[model samples]
Target: MADDSKSGGDLEKDQRSQEDAPPSSIYLISYPKIVFLYPTFLVAVVVAIFMSIAGESAQIGGNREHMAEVMSLIFLGVFGLNLTVLAFDFPRTTSLTLFFLGAALFMGAWMLLRFNPDIVPTITGLLKGLRPWANSQMYWLFASILGLIFIGVAISVRFDYWEVKGNELLHHHGFLSDLERFAAPNLKIDKEISDIFEYLLLRSGRLVLHPRNQPRAIVLDNVPFISRKEKQITRMLGALQVQVRPDNH
Candidate 1:
């Protein structure tokens, strides 16, 4: 069966060629996906700066308590926006229950205020008791630390991160260049978008890579465009498997 022998030889040749071929794609994992925290931190810095400037005004001394109250409200509102799915998403029944509860409270408050105008002064007094102010040193410190952490993360990502190639996964780390490799083909991958606010910020989430025979899985968080990465890895691994599958001779 010369024909059969020739086909077998050709298949072996193709396998050799495919093995020698360069990787179809390479992925470098980095840490800039934590972009959402920047906006709020930057806003906090601005608020701190505003307080310092306004502190110099003659009217500011007299109204320091008022500024403190306003600052607290602003911080509360902005920070509340960061609650992600914890706030926006709820079970259908749960949402309806909360809606009804809120409606009832609003109606009760409306009726009370309508009949008892004296409550307005009491509510104002309660609000005026809250004084929250960030001193200049505190805001500057907050902004500085955040800036430093971001910079350090950037540099660390540039040098110490993970890489995916056509055949293997690479973990690049350390100043002295410690490196490890794991089989990428047949790698199990899981992607998670646990936080909706995070998804809205950068289309990012967590990617878990389960390499064969490895006791522990690798989880990379704040990965940007994670869905795209997962698809690319799937296609790459699928192609790799097809190319390497055993054929009956």
Candidate 2:
């Protein structure tokens, strides 16, 4: 009797523990492509800090001036590259590779011309005019504005997001906490990494969810850490299926 009672107590404790455990679910939040500009934002912040330090130092003539010019050039290059990426979609890795190759060839040609100034005196004069120059204060102002914009983006996303649970898919939206639920029993999910560059930036991709009885799939784009979320949803649904499967007679 005592052994049976102890076993019963152990079973009760196991059930209670299971009840207390957090749900195994994934929250899917889609972000805008501007979020990927974080690389440029980070670079700006770093440049601001470096320039501030350089400005404070006693040695502020030849080397300091050169370093500031280099920093400004780097900042402009990154900003231009970021804008170029935003303007176009590199859907395939081949396209991305081609872009890099083209950029490299252009840079190589420019460098060759720069070194052999006699060949194209006009080229050196044009390059001198193209040099981007900015002070430490300018860098700080740019970083501050970008940082605030990022914060706004973060806050705006909270109003609309999706949650995937063991037995259902949920869309939670609106300022008033509106939620729409769909059955997950026969849910179909497709993961598409459409843009190679975007994926490289944030491991982001599109998730197409085909919920049971729905005529159209719910397409969510710019989802960060997409692979992990897909695996998690798969595991949750697989486990749910196993739990509900009928035994052979």
Candidate 3:
């Protein structure tokens, strides 16, 4: 009876300690700075809005000539937004950004050729001075789609949060009430530095963890500053054993 009571008390104490532990400090392994990118994007948005208004006025006035300028401005705005996403460290962001950038460049080239036939002498000579009217509707349509994609990516990244606590890793993704937890206790962690560009740019690091009784390993890629993360994981694991650098490896 006495032994049972003593075991119960110890279990309660352990539970209390775990419950009382402080929350982990979340770290963004890699996030791009908004300072430089935001300004350029803002400028592009302003230009687009101005061009949109001007184009509408021109259409109302029956001029219809200023429509090309409006399309160019809208393209510029999309290009700027794409640049901003590229500035962010998101991998998929770059692909989408590049796609939009390429589309904008293609459209811009077409618009230039359409408005200024003399600029492309070969095409002008071949076509015999055929001019294409600017498609104002398509200009705003593509811009709106690109803008929505940009906003979606931004929101997704902003809401995703990841952190490491003592012997545990937590990820909170999505808008609200969505959480995922992963925990490993005093497990062996190995880090490998690969990629020549990663070494030069100092932006890539890999974390490999071998957990007990787990057939598969946990691998984290594109982690920044390996040494610091190694130390953090080391300290957290060491705390479990009440000793640093266990000889067992």
Question: Lowest summed-lDDT stretch of 10 residues in model 3?
Answer: 30-39
lDDT of each: 0.72, 0.85, 0.59
Q: What is the clash count for each candidate, in the order shown?
A: 0, 0, 0
lDDT of 3 by residue, 1-249 (tens): 999999999999999988754345535353333322433444445555655666643542364445555445555665665564445443443555766788899899778877998898897686553333444455456556656765765676656755676665666677774876666575788887554334234444667767666688767665667666777667666666664445874
The pairs that clash in candidate 1 are none
lDDT of 1 by residue, 81-147 (tens): 5543334643444655875797799789868766776779787566556666555566678778878
TM-score of each: 0.62, 0.84, 0.38
Badly placed stretches (over 4 Å) of model 3 are: 1-23, 27-44, 56-67, 70-161, 171-181, 184-213, 217-249
Q: Model 1: what TM-score?
A: 0.62
Question: With candidate 1 superimposed using the best TM-score fit, by how many Å does residue 124's alpha carbon deviate from the native?
Answer: 3.8
Off by over 4 Å in 2: 1-23, 56-65
- Name model 1 segments beyond 4 Å from true: 1-36, 48-72, 80-117, 120-123, 135-138, 242-249
Question: Model 3 lDDT vs. the true structure?
Answer: 0.59
